[model samples]
Structures are given as structure tokens and as C-alpha cells.
Target: MFVKTMRDDKLSLLLTLIFSALCLLTAYRSMSMIAEVLLFIVLGIVYFKKSSIKEELNQREKLFIFAFIGFFVSALTSWIVGSGWELRSVRNPSMPSLIDLDLPSKYLLGALVFLLCVRLKWCLSPKVFGYAIGLGAMVNGCIAIYQHYQLGYSRVYGWSGIAEMAEASALLAVLNLVLFVFASCKKERIFYFVAIFLACLACIFSGTRGSILGFVVTFLFVGVMIFWKKRELLPIFFVGVLAGGLAFVPSLTLEQRQDTMRFDSAENDLKQYMQGNAHTSIGMRFEMWKEAIVMFQMAPFFGLTSAEIEKKMPEILQRSGSALVGIKKANPNNDARGKKHNQILNQAAKKGIVGVIALLLVWFASFRLFTPFLNTSGNSLIFSFCGVSILFYLIFPSLVGEPWESNVTLPLVTLLICAFYKIQKGQKIGY
Candidate 1:
């Protein structure tokens, strides 16, 4: 019995280490996938060893799991009914040609992870996870800063060489926000403070307007919440702000600052769109959103397939006189380049109202879990931060991209939710 218990503990430790690595190494999708597969294998073994499959879960957990499963089912149904197989090549001929199928599979994987964590009690130590994520953010942040120095401040990509600058910046911003909250709650950890500073530098250098806005908004909200509970920390917050501003001053050139602020005026963006100029970043997104809404209207319930969207986009553009003059004039074959930047619209375009409902349920369930710990103490504070971090990801991404489809964002979110659930259930996380 002693030997068996020790073996189980060792297995648990190994799982935690892999999970931590996944949190940090998300820039490499292949690596993250391999780690996730290994984790699932270990979880399967643990599940089989249990005397019974029954495990106690709160209502929120159950709802989240159900919503996740619903999302997968709805996505799969859309793929099948919408005849996704026939249009796979036209959608993306370069890859294996089953992008829609892959998305549903990913969703199922997340659901399984949530179930295993709840049933087998596989929640790892939050402190360990936080440190791992912080370290990862610091490394990525350093890379971004270096890139800005080496490649100029046009746009900086971190270790995630293939991902867009905005996507990478957004991920770092969310991770850094969590670290900031952890540092505030712990108060003694200089590691998190340094991590936050590095992350801020990365955000500034990346030159992604949405990411910068998200980081500022999230931290401002966190600061207010922290100060509401403990007003004495106000001075510390200001000092940190001063330090961050000083550190970032060198990189914040007039051109770079203006580039970041280019999309600030909504009225100007609309004017650019009305003039049929999709060259501007904000203008392109507005045009895409309009196209996405049209696609959603075509099949309000089940959604049009990727092939159908591809087939119809030209007609829609031609009819609306919004042919994305910049893209069309430059490369006629690449007219299908723009994507629905907003998550809700993206889902509505791909899987229709069913997909939208499932996503909404997932968001609702997430908040349901976190709402209780909003004003709690001790470990609950950390859990609340985790909740808020997830909320930020959900909210901020809807403005510019489909964050739910991201390999890094969704899995990390699942792991964090599971960890917080374990804490809420009074399970002692092993260090």
C-alpha cells in the first residue's frame, strides 16, 4: 500500500510538471499537443484505477462540462450537416484539410480534461502553475523586447514565431494579468512583479492595439478590486505604474505610439470603411464583421459551411461594393484572406445559433464558478484572479479574434478552471 501510494504521488507530480510546461510552451502548438496527449494518457490510467467513476462536482462544474460537450456536439453536427468534407480543400488546401473537424476534437479534449480533473482530483498546486506561467511569460516578454530592438518597432513577435503579433500579445497580456494578481495577493513574490514588468514591455513592443487595451483594462479592473479591499496598496500600484512607464519609455517612439493609436476613433474607422478602403487594420475588421453578419443571416440556425462562405463571399462583396480594394488589387486569388475577428460572429458564421448558445453557456458557467469567490480571502483570492483572467480572455478576444479556437488559450483556461474548482472544494493541492 505504501509503495502504491508513493507511485501514485509520483505520477501526479509528473502530470503537474507536464501541465506547467504546457502553460509556458504554448507558442509551439506541436509541443503543446504532445504534452496534452501524454496528460490524457496518464489521466486515463488514473481514472481506471479508481474504484468507481462517481465523483462529487458542484453545479457549476457540471454545467461547464455539459456546455463544453454541447459545443463539441454542435460543431460536429454543423460539419456534417453543412457538408464540411466537400469544401475542406477550398477552405485550406495546405493543411490536412479538416480544420472544422479538428476544432470540435479540441473542444472534446478540453471537456475530457475538465472531467478527469474533477473526477480524479488531478488539480495541481496553483502556486506551481502560476510560477510556471510567469516564467514562460518572462521568457516570451524578453524575446519580444529583443525583437523590437533587433527588428525595429514596426511589430514584434515573441517566441511564437508563426502566430500573429496581436495573438501573441493577447496571450501574454492575459498571462501577465494573472501573474499581477498573484503578486498582489502574495505580496512577497518579487518573481511575479518582474514577470509583470517584462510582460508590459512585451505588450508595448508588439504594437497590437487590442492587446494593449486589454492589458490596461484588465489591470485597471484588478487594481480597483484590490484597492476596494485594501486601500493601502494604492501607493504600491502607483509605484509599479511609474516603474513600468519608465521601463517602456525608451521603446515608445512617436511613430509607434501613433500606430497603436491609429484605431482609436470609431468614427474614423467607419468613414474609412464607407470609402471602401479595407487597407486600414480597423477598416478590414469592420468589413469582415459585416461579411460575417451576412453569412450568419444566410443560415441563421445551422450556419453555412466554409466552402459555402468561400463560394458566396465574392458575390456578397460585389453586391456590397466592399471588395477589399487593397487585397483585391494586390492579389486577386487571396480575396478570402479576411476572417471574422469577433468570436461570437465567427461562431455564428460557422456553426450558427447553436454554436453561439453553447459558447454563451460556457461563458456563463465560467462566471458561475468564479462569482462566489469574488470577495473571499486566502486561497480564494488566487482563485478569483484565475476566474477574472479567464473572463478577460473571453471578453477581450470577442473584439478582435476567435480566442476560443486558440490551442494555447482554451487549454490553459481549462487547467486554470480545474485548479480553481479543486481549491473551492477544499482539496489540499500538493506542492
Candidate 2:
């Protein structure tokens, strides 16, 4: 009986422990890799609990799982094609590989978390799960504040890059708000509220405009969900007004002095870039997107190998009427270090048609996983809200930045998605 109890205790802690460590460890090291290792450990333990996973899988869950598998498989297939059919991890990005299996492949490990959540729902603790994310965000927030004031860094990236810091914090802030709303007591509420504030501070300090877009989208999503629930136009109208005003938040890196919004000069930055000054923050991304489009056209079906993509840069740069002339002047060897800043374009350019289809499949299945839950009420509705919120949080920012490529963002997104994937089937009510 004691051994059984101890085993159950470990099972209860599986998700919480891994995710809590992720929020803390990812800032210092390569979290996706760490998470992969930890997930396999959990898998080994789960191998013993095969009897407990008696819940029959549904069609949607099955489809999502398959789609997830297909996405990674397609990427691997492309990598094989790019690596001349080599089956090993291609460490050199400038080498012949089509996909960067080094980090992006770890995204597949998220399937373990999803499956565990579905099978071991009985052992999971929502409070522990919620608070872990909240505390993690709060800690990062505190560090960002310290970096901003004491360390004298222009943008407080903490240990991660400014993009990762801003993007991830803004996402956590919104998710933490859901926790704040559903807290049973003052202590939980205080913890989540402080977490929300600090996370937002980190977002602002990191100053990624994409996080601001996340804020606007989140506000609009809330308003829409509210109206969808209450079926009232008046509340939605007010929410729209609030959302419009709140649009003043979220931006990418556009300044050296301030990490947050640079609305006053954002227009100027674009105008200058249009006039052959492609050094602005927005300009660099826009230029890359344009070149990436050209890259995609060159290899429309299977896409180019990373080496081939790098090879094409000289021709794109040397074109007589190319917009990249300023980029060349700004950084003569600016091949974007062989990466397109946009996720859609980057995937399309590097992995081609198969890659694009894989991406779409992953998005569709994942989003569909939470749609049915959103129609629920009470705590279930709140649960779905956070789940869907985390989804959009990943989706929007990823359009501009490759969260998959980041050391922390992919693991962060994956764990958050799995964390919010509440076990909704025939569970006991807990209001």
C-alpha cells in the first residue's frame, strides 16, 4: 500500500514537476532538449502504468496525434532529402539539411505530455499546474526588472533573447489571468495577479512588438468569447472599445533606448526602409520576408536545402533592382545568417510544399482539439479559455518569429499547451 501511494504521488507530480522545471531551467539552458530527456524518463515510468490508461481514445484525439506525427515525419523526410538521405542529426545548419532537427524536432515530444494528460487525468493537479506557470512567469519577470534597472541592458531579455522573453511572458501573463479569475482563495489570486503583472512587465521590458499583437488578439478573443457565451451585443461593444484602446500595447524590437512600444517612430522606420534604409527593426524582417518569398519560388515543390538556400542569397542580393541593396550595405554578409525571420516563410522556403502542408495540419488539429471544450460552461469553460488562449498566443507571435527555433519558446509553448489540455472526459465536477 505504501509503495502504491508513493507511485501515485509521483504520477501526480509528473506534469507539474517537468513543467515547473522547464519554466525555471529554460532560462539558463537548452530547455527543449532537457524537456525531451525528462519526457522520456516520464515515459519509462508510464510504461508501468499501461493498465491505468484504460480510457479509449476518441477520433479527434487520434487525428491530432496522427497529424502531429505526420508533421515531424514530413520534416524528417525533407531533412533526409536535404542531407542526401543521411539519417543522423545534421548539426551544421549551413550543411545540406533541409530541416533543423536539432531543436524543432523536440516539438514532437509534446505528444507525450498530451497523451499523459489524457491517460493520467486522475492524478493531475490543476492548482499545482497553474501555480507552477504563474510562479515561473513571476520569477522571470523579477529577473527582467532587475536586468532593466541594475544590469543596464536596454531590453531586459533575462537569460533568453528579447524576442523569447517578450513573447513567452506576454503569453504567460494572459494564461495567468485565467488562473487569477478562477482562484479559490486570496493566496492563489495574489500569486497569479503578481505573476500577471510581472510577466507583462517582462513583455514590456523585452519590448517585442509581437507580444503587443498578442495582447490585442487576446483582448479581442476574450471579447468574442464573452459574446459567444452571453449572446449579448452590448458587452461585446464595450469590449471592442476596450480592445481598440489596448492596442497601444505589443511591438517587436524597434528601439535601443526602450524595450516596449515605439509607435511614434514605427512609421518612420518603415518609411526609411522603403527609401532604401533597411536597417530598422521592422525593415530587416520585411526584407527577409521578401527574399524568403523569392527563395520559396525557386524550389516550389520540395524546397531548397539549407545550403542551397544560403547559396541563393548572393543572387538575390546582387539583383540590380533588388530591395536588399540596403541590407547588403548594412551588413555586407547579411544572409540573415541563413534564416528567414518569419515562420511561415521560413518553413515554406526551407521545407517546401510538404513542410507547409505539415504546418497547416499541426495547426488545424491542435486548434480543433480545444474548440469543443470552449462551448462548455463553469470551470470547464475557463479551462477551455486558457487552452485556446495558449494556442493563439503561440500562433500569432510565431508568424513573425520562429518559436520552434528558440531554445526556450518551443518547450514553453508545448508544455503550456499540454498543461492547459485539461482532461474533460467524464471527470468529476470541482467547483
Candidate 3:
């Protein structure tokens, strides 16, 4: 059945569309287990088809190879650390068992499934890829509005831990907005503009500072590309979009404004700690990062075993003196209690220097694959936008949350990275 779908391009397109819609709806409904399972099933079916093996190892595949290496290494190290080191000295040894089961499994599954799709060329098209992400953003955006309707403020709406879901939705919104703007470059369609506008609007409501910054950086990148190509009229077109984008800012609720404003402030408790206050979330993250760096410094080569780091957390927290009593009170979901906001720092803390090195290699690999298109002179606007969008999203979000772990953004980044190479190389494979 899946093979039949693969053979029919029309069916493949339809599957992509339906899957896109399902992704968005899942966000709104908060059906993540179902969403993950359904996506896996669909991806599985697409790969099961024994189609043209020659088509498998295209530019897209090569790009994925780079990201896959990084993703695989990160997961492998995380699993090793989470299972061997982090779990060693836990209070209720069984508690570690649950983390060992869920955390690594999701990463492993996502990595394998994405690799299989690239091998099968499933969900590889720029158009379909854009639609899928756009749909997902649309769903989350609707969910944010819905949350505001029910609870009076916008927050993440899915099974993904609140921070992860919010970041993922924000990242996707940035990507979708870029694609939507690029799409506008070719044709003038009101529906396209409206849909993209709504998606960007949702991104604003998400209150994710990283995504907002990512969107701004993406626009700047687009401007550079347009200028490089001497496309003079693009600015007027973009300003119109910017105007529309700005119009929605004042629409945010008071609660939404307050929560999201923390994102804009550089004066979090960290500033107070530097002066003398000592009790800010920023200070805690700084403490975690410093302790992590010390652990890495001590075990620079093999890195501190995850077990060692886990055992040292209490001691580290105590020494840093960044502890707070009611810190957990700010969270409504209760899941935000213990997460380091930096992906790089998290990797260092868990996998030490070795993990950090592996992650850098993965970033290099992904960037290397896309370098060809970025430097090329053809109409690879979609591909260029994808690369820039991922770059900005990762860089900006690293300050806000550790999204590289278990969030949909990681795969989306990989997918876009793969799509850039695939679209460029696929064109030469003779249709």
C-alpha cells in the first residue's frame, strides 16, 4: 500500500498534505503520542517501498548524512550519559529508569525515521516540506489563541514539554514565514499572504524570543539575497509584509505581554546577581554552565561520565548558591522545573567534551552540505531561506531553551538541511 503511494506522485503529494494538516491539528488537540506514532507510521510506509535506489543517494541524502551523524552522536552520547552516569545516584533508582526509557528512545526513533525518509525520498520536496512545517505552525498558532481563550494567556499546547513545544512552534513559524515571503516573490496571492500572516501572528503569540529573533534575522538574510541578485523591488514588497506583521503586536493580552516581555529584558535576575541580588533564573543557568564547564575542564577528553555529572548536580547547585525556593511556582505545567536553557551546555554537562565535539562536527557536516547551494547562483531561494532559517533559529534559541533535545525543531532543521541539498541535486537526476 505504501509502495503504491510512493509510485504515484499525486498520492505522495496528497499524503504530504494530509500529514501536514494532521501535524497542525495534533498541536491544537494536544495529541502528541498519537502525532508521533502517526508520523512514524506514515514515514515507515513511505520507506518500505522498494523504489529507485539510484534516486536515494541524491543531494538531499548527502545533506541528511551530515545532520544524521550529529543527531546520532548526540543521542548516543545522551543515552550513554543518561543511562550510565545520570541515573547512577538517583533517589528512587526507578525514576532514572523512566528517563532512560523515554528520552533516548525519542531521539533514537526520530533520527532513524528521518534517515529512512531521506533514503526513501519521502517528504523531501521543498514545497511539501514548506507546507508540512507551515501546517504545523498554523496548528500551534491556533492552539496558542485557543489557550488564550481558555486560560487567558498563550502557552505551548502539545505533549512536547512546554518549552520544547513553544520553541518548536516558534522555529517552524519563522521557517514558514520565510517560505511564505519567498513564495510571494513569484506570485501575488491574497490567500498565500493571509495564511502566512496568520502563521507569523501565531509565532508572535508563542512568546518565544528566539523565534522572533530568528524571523528578523531571516528577513535580513532574504534582503541580502535579494540585493545580491539586484532584485530592487523586493524591499517594497517586504515592507508591506513587515507592516502587516507589526500591526499584530498590539493585539497581545496583558498576561501575554508580561510573560513574553521577560524575553525582551536583558535585566533578568542575572544582572542583579552580577550587582549582588544572587537569586535569578539567569544566575542558576550561569551556575549550571560554570559547573558544567568545570566538569568538562576536568575531563576534557573523555568528558565527565553522565553518571558523574548526575551525582554532582546537588553539590554543584549547592556550590553555585543559585538555588531558589519558589522558582517552581512560576510554571503552570510543572514540567519546567529542571532544564538548562542551553543546548550546548546541556551536552557538555551530560556528555562532556566528547559530546560537544561530536555536536560541532554534526553542525559542520550539515553546514558543509548546504554550502554548495548557498554559494551557488541559481534560483535556490527556497533552499537558501531554509538554511538561514535553521541557522538563526538554532543560534537564537540556544539562549532561551535547549531545543536540540526532543523537540520537533531538531528534525525540522535536519529536514530543511536535507531539502536544500536534495532540491539542488535532484534537479540534475533527470526528473
TM-score of each: 0.83, 0.82, 0.75
Candidate 2 Cα lDDT to native? 0.64
Q: Estimate, for each residue in 1-431, the C-alpha lDDT of model 1 and write its tens digit.
A: 32344356776578768877865765554555577677678887888887474477768778888888889888888878877765535456654346676666777887887787777744466567677767766776677767766766556665443234444444555555545544645553467667667766666666665666776676676677668765666666655555445536655566565543344455577787688666676787877777778778888887876656656766656654665745644543344333478889888888899989988988888778777776776666666666666576457756787767776556656665766666555433332
Ranking by lDDT: 1, 2, 3
Highest-lDDT candidate: 1
Model 1 misplaced regions, further than 4 Å: 1-8, 29-31, 52-54, 90-97, 151-153, 161-187, 227-247, 255-275, 325-338, 423-431
Model 3 alpha-carbon drift over 4 Å, by segment? 1-15, 26-63, 70-111, 121-136, 154-161, 184-189, 240-244, 251-256, 263-271, 314-338, 375-380, 415-425
Predicted structure 3: lDDT: 0.54
Error of 1 at 175 (Å): 5.0
Pairs of residues clashing in candidate 1:
none
Write down the worst ten-residue block by lDDT for model 2: 239-248
Which digits, one per residue and each the tens of the lDDT, describe model 3 over residues 334-407?
21124456778766655666667766666676556555566554336456656755666576677656655544
**Candidate 3: worst 10 consecutive residues by lDDT?**
328-337
Between prediction 2 and prediction 3, which has the larger lDDT? Answer: 2
